[model samples]
Target: MRKTDLLAALALSAAAVLPAAAADEVNVYSYRQPELIDPLFEAFTEKTGIKVNSVFLNKGMVERLKAEGRRSPADLVFTVDIGRLNELVEADVVQPVRSATLEANIPAAFRDPEGRWFALTARARVAYASKERVKDGEITTYEDFASDKWRGRICTRSGAHPYNLALTAAMIAHHGEQATEEWLRGVKANLARKPQGNDRAQVKAVWAGECDVAIGNTYYMAKMLADPEQREWAESVRIVFPTFENGGAHMNVSGVAMTRSAPNRENALKLMEFLVSDEAQRLYAELNAEYPVKPGVPPSELIRSWGEFTPDDLPLVEIARNRPAALKLVEKVDFDG
Candidate 1:
């Protein structure tokens, strides 16, 4: 081959081999919004010198991961709701994480039995009552909504939403399916309007005098209060952490998992451990307004001012297991109707 031709052939022969993640890099597939979680990742990178790549997804995490198969670039999966996390586990896309740091920081109830997932933060499903209309101690328990006293006075989003489904599934755990069915029917009877809008909308309903109270997640109060436009909506309602007659307040989680196809397993596990560290937990409470998963780390000032209560000890796995039945109950009751 001539010199120019030989050079061209050699350059062509040098295939561009796409390497896996660099030694100091980890990739994440997340269902949570990037803005809410970016700070945590940024902090992780700052402290550990590991580059974190995040892919945000609203749907199809399982399908995408399944499609990627063993060649998937995802090292960790971050998502909210036990239902979605369980979907990953059920789909067999995530592998068990055998980290002592994870086991030490996370409670057994919040960790999967086989160690496939770990709860990083928790949110309680609580009631939001109109400050003007509802008495301070009038509704103190989840069962209170089932009383005729709350009839035509309560508001909530669709019962089948994963948040509500997890809460309902908890009801089934504490009370039998039969009794939970009765309680749900009673709660449905009390709807101030058609099961509509989101957790924020339910609070907005309370502000508009459309309802006396609404059932929603505890963190939403901080979120609403943070927004200038929604301040009035937040101010109109008081958070009520309602306990079950037989258990603590129902809670849900946003969690993390190691992908079965992780190419950077050590760095991925480092990121996981960092996430559960005190610095990261503090950032989570302060930035995202979520309750930290690590013990001894208190929530932000806003959450503390809301008062403290025991989170129900029912394992999230137990709650997730009942999601199908919970959805069936929501449909059976025609809750959204």
Candidate 2:
């Protein structure tokens, strides 16, 4: 062949490669707020040249995934809360991904045995109390939330919220139905006001002197320090990991799973593996302010500053399994108060 003919053939081959390169993009459905996750998305794309197209929502992703079904354009699901992840698995919207890298990065406690979903970060339902009003050694466990000293002085988000509901489920897992009911009754009697708002609001209530003790995830305290207006809300309160006295602090997860009908299965697995990789794990910590599920990955300096403690190793799937019973118990105990 002539030199000119060879050059023309090479140019045709390059043209054929362009579309596949462009198709490297992955579509994602995320329950995380965009502002919280977009930076990481940008970073992933920068590193791998795989563009990310995502839909962000605060509610109803499982139903949406069901509606989308096999025809779903979404290739991945990213969500908060083990209950939601389990719901996706039970609904058959997410399929198991057998990625050795993900299995290696995430601890057994943070992932489904079937690999349907894997947690990227962890958050604890901890106690926050007045820096001056509640002495350091005065409270050390979730059981302490029920004591009469905190009665009429505790604040919290609605028990119906997934975070609280999951924590309630953890209680059921550890103490049995009867004991959990009594504990809820005690916590209800102690409410400073009706359960309302997000975790940050609970800290605000403590700062305003509306309450002395509140329940919130450890990360919300970091959120407070990051937001100028809310930094002081966290000021008057110190985070206390409720080590359960008998077990460990109740924990929840933010995790990801592949769509049941992912069109780009190989790329989906790649993304999942990348997410659990050391570099991505560090980015997850910096951007999200939650503890990394990858055992050796350090969390944001803020999270580390909050101090470290043992996490309750309860199979998180159990919390998801008992969510319905937990919600029922919450109603029975009138935790809505």
Candidate 3:
């Protein structure tokens, strides 16, 4: 079925399960998987007596919200990646939220200047180095991936993927366009094979002796370790927190935004505030194996085991702004081909 059709069916199913006009309820259009977020919703409902209804969309969330216009049932939109949040802001479908609780809980670096969006959790773009083939301290920075020593020894997903694009954008933020392009060319030259598969697949390649290092997110290690089939792959590589020359490790986020056509604005605000609470932050960190955006809240023990590094201070807005240039460079370099 088409993505829109599937979204419509899921919306209808959600409506059937929960009252359409419930007096105390909030609706969400989320890109996050239900299993990853339902527990938080349940906790919110239990604590506040507010019903939470959600529709999961794999793609086309901004288009769907645009189509619904003022009648859209969505109160909040949940998604990962700054590029996606910027899309909602650019579409003018989300409104600015002024909440003291949010400002105090989330750091200034992780939120929008105009209060249009707030990040909930953070993940780093890191390397999964083969335990046997890669020695400790051999890889310490993202720039090392482009070194001649790594030629034919690295693996990654498609350059066009949002995750890779964000990383590329960060490169541009650190080094100007020409230098970033050169860096891209160098990294492309090091690929063991054509850029293919998701982040986990890169790690699997390392396990299969296809490459010495795989570029991926930190949470995937926990996820792979949890799955019995991929446990061997998880065990074969160790997470490496590479930095940007003088800066720290590169970080990305999963964030939330309040929609403009919020029918239950009050309830939505309540949920938004609740999501950043210490309790909720802890739940999110433990459940998703992510680093919570809230200060004083710790990540799950499993996540902490991967070790820690200072996060890059480069603002996410800069990364989002550089996305167009990043894509153009990717195409120019033909990183995927």
Candidate 4:
């Protein structure tokens, strides 16, 4: 990895604050990996003279920016999941934006209502069930995990993982906290083994005959299919879009937000607007295997093959607001312990 791909640390000196040499540049603090975003940056620079200097952080983005105070070099932040985006908003490290282009490109359900964040890509939290062991329509909703039918057959990562937490948060948005709590306990009781590994690992366990079903993001299927080693895992299962009892499928996003202390405000906003452009949306599908936030910009061929379904239209802010409750519910159930 390049030196720019540094993890989160308050190690930057005053001089290090300037991510690029030129004045017409945007410094990005991103949780999205460098490889996933470098192509987009190259395209942006090619189209406009504004340079993009990005540092990828795996964790603690809100804390780092808060510690940097008004001196933080970040002009924009790109991160996965609404939970992290909400953290930036709550920390007051990022400010709301107003851009006609962005507003036009992104759907209301996908972007922050206040414009504090805009989604660049969307991923559905779908079930991966064994094609051989699980029959058609065996599981059809998020609530199905708690049923006696799936006991000791469901696999997932830690409930505290942001992805699972987001799903839990969505559950809170659809059902009240009290109901979500009971549901969590039920789901916990159904775990095939102690919740372990990444989403792919869950799918692997399913393929390995350890579980009949796993919960994971849609993009993981495309990613695993592209990898020679993981392709069999991808092929061994079928993607199943599950709904909330009262809502459609649960969805998550890879989002962008503007830093509160943007030195290159104009350039930063320009980069953000450009990210939602049709061209960037297409690249997002090609490079990241993610669905675009902009309508009419089709997903990559491999992504299209996975099929589509209606994502729950619940506004992301509602789900984001429930993150704390979701975390608390996870802890209450001792889901990971």
Please tell me which predicted candidate would have the highest lDDT against the true structure: 3
Native-referenced Cα lDDT, model 3: 0.92
lDDT of 3 by residue, 1-337 (tens): 9877865765555445433445789999899999999999999999999989988888888887776667678889999999999999999999999999999999988999899999999999999999999999999999878999999999999999999999999999998899899999999999999999999999999999999999999999989999999999999999999999968999999999998988888999999999999999999878888999998998988998899889998899999999999999999999999
Model 2: what TM-score?
Answer: 0.91
Off by over 4 Å in 2: 1-22
Q: Estimated TM-score per prediction?
A: 0.93, 0.91, 0.95, 0.94
Better-scoring candidate (TM-score), 3 or 4: 3
Model 1 residue 330 distance off true place after TM-score fit, in angstroms: 0.9
How good is model 3 by TM-score?
0.95
Question: Which candidate has the top score in TM-score?
Answer: 3
lDDT per residue for candidate 2 within 1-337, as digits (tens), equals 9755654554343234322223588777799988877877887888888887777757766666665556666778899999888889988999887877887888888999999999988888888989978887888888778889888999999988899999988888888899989999999999989999998898899999899988898888877887899988888888888887689989998999998867767767778888888888888877778888897878887788877789999989889988999999998877885
Q: Model 1's lDDT to the true fold?
A: 0.89
Per-residue lDDT value at 138 in model 4 = 80
lDDT of 4 by residue, 1-337 (tens): 5433342246354237556334778888889889899999999999998889888789777877877777788888999998888888888988989989999999999998889999999999999999999998787889878888888989999999999999999999888899899999999888899998999999999999999899999989978988999999999999999999888999899999998888888988888888899999999767888899899999988888777788899999999989999999999999998
Local accuracy by lDDT, each model? 0.89, 0.83, 0.92, 0.88
What tens-digit string does per-residue lDDT give for candidate 1 at 123-154? Answer: 99999999999998998889878999998999
Q: Could you tell which candidate, 1 or 3, scores higher by lDDT?
A: 3
User: Which scores better on lDDT, 2 or 3?
Assistant: 3
Tell me, what's the RMSD of every candidate? 7.5, 9.9, 2.3, 3.5
TM-score ranking from best to worst? 3, 4, 1, 2
Residue pairs clashing in model 1 are none
